[model samples]
Target: MDPNQRPDDERLSAWLDGELDSAATAEVDAWLREHPEDAARVRLWAADRDALRARLAPLADEPVPEAWHTLVRDGGRSAAPAPAPRRGLPLAWAAGLLLAGGVLGGLVGAGVVWNSPELQVALQARGWARPSPLAWTHRAAMAHAVYAPEVRHPVEVNVAQGSAAEQRAQEEHLARWLSKRLDMPVKLFDLRAHGFELVGGRLLPDAAGPSAQLMYQNSGGQRVTVYLRRPEAGADTAFRYQRDGELGLFYWTEDGFGCALVGNLPKERLLALAEAVYKQVEDGIVRTPDGGASRPDSLQPAGGRPAS
Candidate 1:
């Protein structure tokens, strides 16, 4: 293949991981050299990857926690399968990084699960699918990881801390602007019923296209983000869930839009919120064989079924 032919993110990522064969690696190397712009982007990715490794590297030195041993032991006994890795290091490495959390890189969040190979196997024994490498889903998780820690300016538009009417107006404006920009109906899923109120949202840049992130918070001040965008070609509408360090995510596609609800909430809590979102989204569309614009009582949430 011509080096001038641009490599997609996956190839570049593989190059970063040294996962590509020599020929492919050389091709990417040549491509990077000939295209300074591509090289710059790859360099940024390399930096981030290195930073993450460095952040988690010390964990490998600490004594493995007793909990890790127990989980790994039980994992083998239970015959649970680990989550399949999508890129870079194996899932075990990422999963190990979670259990080692304790002021390490300050990446720890609530409701995080240790997803090492054995633990993943255990999760699989319980019939859970590993989080897929769906780009938007990972982006949602990354966005949450980046902004959830902010004590100020977590979102561009904040519906909270404003008068009731102003909040409503802001909510309306957020929905309208994001919908128009992404060319999809951007319903601000009402999670107030589940103890989380809208905190407003902001436009986000996505490699696939323009995306939006809506923040929500509870009385306790815990925050979550809903990342939304139009579905890519061949995007599945399966309601999927994944836990990354402290972040828990439930993502699905509906009515031509892809959405991922991200937070550090427990799986059950996140599921309830996700279901609330699913129901609200379902309410806005009619269910018909042809998906005609009519509502039905038995409509199921997107992602092919409701997440258990």
Candidate 2:
């Protein structure tokens, strides 16, 4: 906003966002010190600023491409997902779009689970009734894609901190983490039962946005990954189940997230496994490298579900 056209309150916001020149900022800062109500609003702005920084912190000071705001705000839900924003902007700008949802609400950001072409194909397969196993493969493959690339931390509970055996133990803790959110009697499918042991999982990009994924393998070493995200599209439906080709997939959205159980298996068998695994995988508990569970403290408020 032009400094000349800015209203008193707007100026205060500019000051808070650090948009004003040093002299103007100092002026607004002084005014806020004297005005209790405005000061309270400043505090709110500060909280909001911190929240947005934390939510987008992973992007490495990358510029939220012009398209990101446009995509997010205009309900960019094309079947062909938008490419992730170009990063490494000059970092000279002092202003931001500041999503109207407030910086705090950015915490509710659905992580990377819904942008992949593979996953989008899965969604289309379910609806289009084409060779469907690809959908399941889409889901599992993404889970591996998102988390395995981490540098500082991989799993929420890092058994890697201890012995090699301890690292495997982290797998067990990861299972428990899923169980906690799933709110069910959760367990890794015993190789004898499902022919797969839980290897590990990580977060990933998807058509809907960011998501969590879990990987598993069987005695014969067949593998699967479960991908999860905050639900979008027909998420309110009880469940939209699908199976195509050699892959198996079951997906659902609950609370504020979407989940897909994926594997290379037959339709009925994979559906059952997806349901059972879905029941076992947790909801809303995005685990951090430090082994603590974090939920989106900010929400989109009632009736603000972004359009597909």
Candidate 3:
């Protein structure tokens, strides 16, 4: 098949799910080899599917509730119609619900982990103090996928052009403007040591509020994006990793900021970049060679925001 006529995402997702027959799988493999981006996306979807399965796997082993057992033993009749057995796993339905409503949705609500002892145990085992921020992480990957491929207008602020002084000014303006808008410090991380340079950045509207997206590129033209937003208050801060098809994401929250690095680079390479951004953000300063800070005089016009 012609590369331009590559299969749509449904076919790619089906391939990841092992739903395709051998010939179809082989076709997908050929297409992926020719189109790295699509392959990466499929990998991410597979990773996410696996992670979801792992998180919910324990639910499958929990025995049907006594209420359910009573109903079953009584030939599907009951003196009082017992509410849906919270203790029973209903694994298949739950997985479908997660896929439909979202992974974190319908799993827990308010202070109730569905009022299931088994589910509570599973949550504890999973180290979930609250609903996972997985839904937001998915959004981050989507944002990267949508914007990183653009040949032009990949960023709102064009900081790579103009004279040296003008470029510095633009960078400063970008940092300060995003910082002000986001209500937190936004630092422009320099990744040149790792063979990536600042391309520019854009403002994005997030589900929670305004967010920032910084784009970078290597000499080979491979692009990566850094997504930043204020995390939900009291959210977990542990670093996490997820991949779909060709894209990999390393996301974490710290000091009220949620950050995700999305790229098609190998894990080690992406980790290097993630670590660089993490360290820079933790340090809370982005310095120039002169050891003096530069600030932008005004905010540049912003491109339209992408969906969260």
Instruction: Name the top TM-score candidate.
Output: 1
lDDT of 1 by residue, 149-249 (tens): 55656788787766667776777777779889988767766676678777778898887679999888999989888899887778677888876545679
lDDT for model 3, please: 0.69
Model 1's lDDT to the true fold? 0.66
Cα lDDT tens digits for candidate 3, 1-308: 45468887667766666679998888888888777667656654544454455565555555555775576689988999766644424434343345454443222312234455655554455443333435677677766776786665678897888887888888888988999999987888878788888888989888878999999999999999999998997877778787743578888887668899999889888888888777665544464523343334332222222112
Q: Scored by CA lDDT, what does every candidate get?
A: 0.66, 0.47, 0.69
Q: Which of 2 and 3 is the better model by TM-score?
A: 3
Which tens-of-lDDT digit does each residue in 241-264 have in candidate 2? 554333346666555555566665
Worst-scoring 10-residue span by lDDT in model 3: 299-308
lDDT of 2 at 219: 65
**Which sequence of candidate numbers ranks them by TM-score, best first?**
1, 3, 2
User: Number of backbone collisions per candidate, in order?
Assistant: 10, 35, 11
Worst 10 residues of 2 by lDDT: 88-97
Best by lDDT: 3
RMSD in angstroms between candidate 2 and the native structure over all alpha carbons: 18.8
Q: Would you estimate the TM-scores of all the predictions? A: 0.55, 0.36, 0.53
